[model samples]
Target chain A: MIETTVFAMQVLLLVMGCLFFAVGTLGLFRFSDTLSRIHALTKVDNLGLGFIVLALLPLAPSLAGGLKTVLIWAAALAASATSAHLIARAVHVRPEPPEAKESADD
Target chain B: MTLILNAVAAFLLLTLLIALIRIWRGPAPADRMLASQLFGTTGVALLLLLAHAQAMPALMDVALTLAVLSVLAIVAFVTRVVRIDRPSSGRKAGDQPETHHD
Candidate 1:
């Protein structure tokens, strides 16, 4: 019974994680500007990856493996947040030439 | 359970392909960069799922490496591609005008 329950939970998590990732990418297509796209990618993908990590934790072969798995999530989160900020800062410091009719809102 | 995991992985890959469309068509460099970051996250998730599905522990290490490498790539972009100019002719601007190798 316990094993069956765990399996069900894992399936649920995996499905949810994939959907969240899809939505994050959807944001990229919907949003018009660079900063908005970053906003979507960072926030939504964080949840998506977090769900996948949670699903994998129970199946980890050892305590160390589980920790390593969690560590990957942490490292990715740090990288995403830091890189998003840096990219935004870069865009702010040196504004790019606005392409013609590129942005939806003037 | 394995079937579900595979289905989920397939969906994630589908989303990745959708993201690539934006990467190709994005107006600004930052937009492309953000899409690539999405790729990194999706790739990591896919790696973890693959590790679990295939019973391969070593692949998790590969995920960790990819996570670390993605950050390094962003750092390189910010430092090299994004030009940083010291505020010209203000406080400390006179100290040493910023210079770019290229």
Candidate 2:
């Protein structure tokens, strides 16, 4: 019974994570603006990943393996955030048409 | 159970691919930044799923650190943009209304 229960939980987590990931991907294509897209991606992405992590936590073979996974997650987040910021900054500084530009450009 | 986890990981990878598309086609730097953020999120999700399947705990700590750092990066970017866009005090001497109206 205990084994079955654990298996069930794992399945549940997998489904939930997939759903959120799908939503995040859809948002990437659907949003009209960068800011809006970011908002959508962040919401779904964070929860999706978190759920997946929680689900897998039980299966970790050893403490070392678990810690390694967490470290990888941290590194991924750092890279993503920094790259995004740099790209956004570049966009903000470039010369562009008035209509396509942010109000702050004035 | 392993199959289910594998499927989830695959889906997350797909999400990452979509985000890459966005980054490639992004009209502006901001758009690219948004796409990159998506990548980060998906990457974390993938790592977590993998760890779970492998039964690893250390990966969770990494995910937590990533979450915090990503948020900080966003905040920093916003502040930097705001500072850059701030209006300068360059009022023309003539534009300063003539005080001789008295």
True contacts kept of 2: 0.59
* Candidate 1 chain B, poorest ten consecutive residues by summed lDDT: B82-91
For model 1, the stretches where C-alpha displacement exceeds 4 angstroms are: A97-106, B85-102
Candidate 1 lDDT over A1-106, as tens digits, reads 9998998888788778988898898898788888888898889998999999999888888899889999999988987887787778768776683454245323
Number of the top candidate by lDDT? 1
TM-score of the A-chain for all models: 0.89, 0.73
Each candidate's DockQ = 0.50, 0.29
Weakest lDDT window of 10 consecutive positions for candidate 1 chain A:
A97-106
Q: Compute the lDDT of residue B54 as modeled in candidate 1.
A: 80
Error of 1 at B88 (Å): 7.2
Model 2 chain A worst lDDT run, 10 consecutive residues: A93-102
For each candidate, report what fraction of the true interface contacts it reproduces.
Answer: 0.74, 0.59
In model 1, what is the error at residue B65, expressed in angstroms? 1.2
